[model samples]
Target chain A: MQPKRLSVLGVGLLGGSLGLAVKSVASDCRVIGYGHRRATLDAALALGAIDEGYDDPAAAVRDADLVVLCTPVSLLGEMLDRIAPFLADRAVVTDVGSTKASIVRLSEERHPGIRFVGSHPMAGSEKRGVQFAQSDLFRNAVCITTPTDATDREALEAVEGFWRGLGMRLKRCSPAEHDRLICDVSHLPHAIAAALVTMQEDAALDLVGKGFLDATRIAGGDGGLWRDIFLDNRQNLAAAIGRLRTSLDDLERLLTPESSEALRDWLDRAAERRQAALKP
Target chain B: MQPKRLSVLGVGLLGGSLGLAVKSVASDCRVIGYGHRRATLDAALALGAIDEGYDDPAAAVRDADLVVLCTPVSLLGEMLDRIAPFLADRAVVTDVGSTKASIVRLSEERHPGIRFVGSHPMAGSEKRGVQFAQSDLFRNAVCITTPTDATDREALEAVEGFWRGLGMRLKRCSPAEHDRLICDVSHLPHAIAAALVTMQEDAALDLVGKGFLDATRIAGGDGGLWRDIFLDNRQNLAAAIGRLRTSLDDLERLLTPESSEALRDWLDRAAERRQAALKP
Candidate 1:
């Protein structure tokens, strides 16, 4: 499953990190990166993240055995369509988008012949650009692969193996399930963090301690990137928000003096659950 | 303003840490700790966090020049009542309770001659008890003092100087204002974090990442302790939650295709605000 000629479209944080990580493991493998900006491509080349760089998506994937779309969630579909005609016949394509159902469905419907497996390598920070990329970015992190019935079996396995080779733990699920589950763990939390930040008064912000900062840290991510993710997975995110509101309602009900014990029990349960989820 | 004899009621994390921190700066000061649990008091003694320990609150504060009530928020008023009659004539009293208005008001009305000043040192970890106490726990952290009109000027200055001597950045405001502001920054975040953890499905919990963990870390604090704070400041917390809901509703409206640009702007604003709030 080793990609000898890997083409990474959109050489930002994830793409540049992918290039470095792949090169660290497979030094002889050639990496080609594509970015709309000449400066970004130049930066990737200067960092030795890519052997060569291109502004054209078609040129980037011309001879590559593996092609990964590393653009924003909203641009994934367009990138796939542009690279479809120029992809090598044996090329196995994938993406690093957070949401899966929309892009996975689009790929299945538009390019049925092209083998494309949806992937979300959940390893990154609030940082952007190739300058922040790390060679071990994916190491020991979870990489989820969303495979529908239309997905080619070999391509799914290849994508999973590719992530595993980069020292990632692999998880497989349907794209719809991925969207729903991830909406709860990732998207919903991001939206809530943003809302928390938005709701604060300047006086409150001035008094913020380490807890508030950590609670809202995810809200500091690039908005354009999250905007795409939120819109793409709006349905699941909306439902997740509804569930969160219900949780908040339950908490409100326990705010009374008569429910003092109940409130403590509720908080204790959440604390125990979260503690259990922590990696020992 | 240095107290020769300092009494720390409740020999838990914050109380024990306060004793150690005070001892680090002023070696001659004698620290007396009171805890219902003999084992906890013994642990504080073994850690060198206290010079003497007592099960009775009055015994703990006897002959003390300063007294810090460190019991749970619900018990703070009772602790004050018990220690009031036995306190030295010039003894200045304070508390480390998160919510200030109730206790501050109670002290002003019930124990007017006690020289009580409400303090909240924005320091501590989810980890509990004297075993986790560190001398540097309050160093460089923000210690907010909530003073009422009834608060004595000399007592307020003494409490402020005490915290500053322990290397804490001091801030002062009226008791009601302190509770309202802190509810937005601290208590609301804790409630929201607990809600976030509670709303997650078991499946999503299995896939939790670093971001989710960080966002919910405050939810791991001692539930009984938070329950007291939440209940005491329920009014402010409820208002804060309502504001957060309004912010979320605004975000929901921007989740459409037509509002794509607007959505990005909304998220960008939150991101920018959070970024600006970060420590340089």
Candidate 2:
């Protein structure tokens, strides 16, 4: 029951930082990182995120009590398929993936023998890789855990404890609910911001002001990661896109020459909505 | 010419802040503010952004050697017309409106007798009013000036000199060029963020990780003013939206099942582009 050793996959930003955070907070824990790139492994090693780095997933997960998947969302399923046989029966596998539904489904299929508890630590930066990684990135941030009925309660408890130990506030949700919730709060916004920036190439280039900077600060995020999120939570993302379009369309109507008063009223609601959203 | 006095119209964040900035660096210059709101006038007086406040547009501009319009783009022309009759013949009249083309056009048609130069200090926040005003807001920011053929060289020089005194980095461009540039850098991003955040009311309520926060932070801006910006620069805004959509579409394609290489390539490019853009 005591997880003395932890194995981290994809030692880039999320994985490297996770190793760094876990190793820093729990000094007794031995953290081993598995990186796809030699450069990434070296950087993570230099950063002291891990005692050592392994090039092979099988070699990395051999005796570790925990294996944390830190790769891209698109690679989550494949990672499980590849690392499944190497994992010990007692080893709990978790991921720092953005969406939960697909990861949960993949876990149920690919790692039936090993327990998987999907986690999303609400943290990070516009910067990527180990260099941008910080030990305290998840501190005071929300960490959601989605555990299916097939999940072992023991594994869930241990994952929750790890996140809590890393200074995260943990919440529990169903895989379906987590995906839908994340689509609204996380994924859909990326699509809207990206589309807005991409669509207005010339105008955006010419007149980027503080408002634009504030709006698209996240637009600079890795597009591939966001795109995977959108596709994974397609139904929820579509619904979110629809809701947002209504807001934009309403503004468009209010902007019509005859609707200045309506425009003012809409803005009041928007400002009110914005301030209200910021309260938490 | 020894300009003995100055006038500030609108008396909100930009106008009030400029009034204080102008007075702080040029101590001998007497500055007064004109605003429709009694509270704005009181706040401006309390903030010491103005020597006094005025209710009458004509009275405010009559004895002033400098007049800076700091209201919404929609009202700049009407305001110029209202104050033209009382503007000092030798005075330099300018504005801090977001979009320059429309305001400059307004100035050209409305005040042939008075010297009009258009300006936009590239700064601000969603939090407004005189209380949020600061004298140094203009001090290390870009001060954009839009000079037309009708613009007097001496008037432009005086405007530039005044802003320089406030410690601004002055940059000159045509009003159309200014609008075009801002569409890319400012207005488009706001539109995108706003739309993105609104996409999923429920999802946004749950997952809002730092990525979403960074992506949609500016979605919380003053909607009325932003709506005005969107309408005013519809053509450019539309173009920006288009470009962003293409980028999003391309990313979406890269995330689909068969494109792991493309996904990695996109993330690498995205990281590179963002890092490059972030560099000074």
Tell me, by lDDT, which candidate is best. 1
Residue B130, candidate 2: C-alpha displacement in angstroms: 2.0
Winner by TM-score: 1
Regions of model 2 farther than 4 Å from truth:
A1-3, A200-206, A223-247, B1-4, B37-39, B164-169, B227-255, B258-280
DockQ in order = 0.84, 0.46
Task: Give the per-residue Cα lDDT of candidate 1 at A19.
Answer: 98
Alpha-carbon RMSD of each model: 1.7, 3.4
TM, every model: 0.96, 0.87
List, residue by residue over B61-156, the lDDT tens digit for candidate 1: 999999999988999999998888899999999999998989988898898888898999988888898999999999888899988778898999
Residue A226 in model 1: lDDT: 95
Give every prediction's interface RMSD.
0.7, 3.4
TM-score of chain A of each: 0.98, 0.92
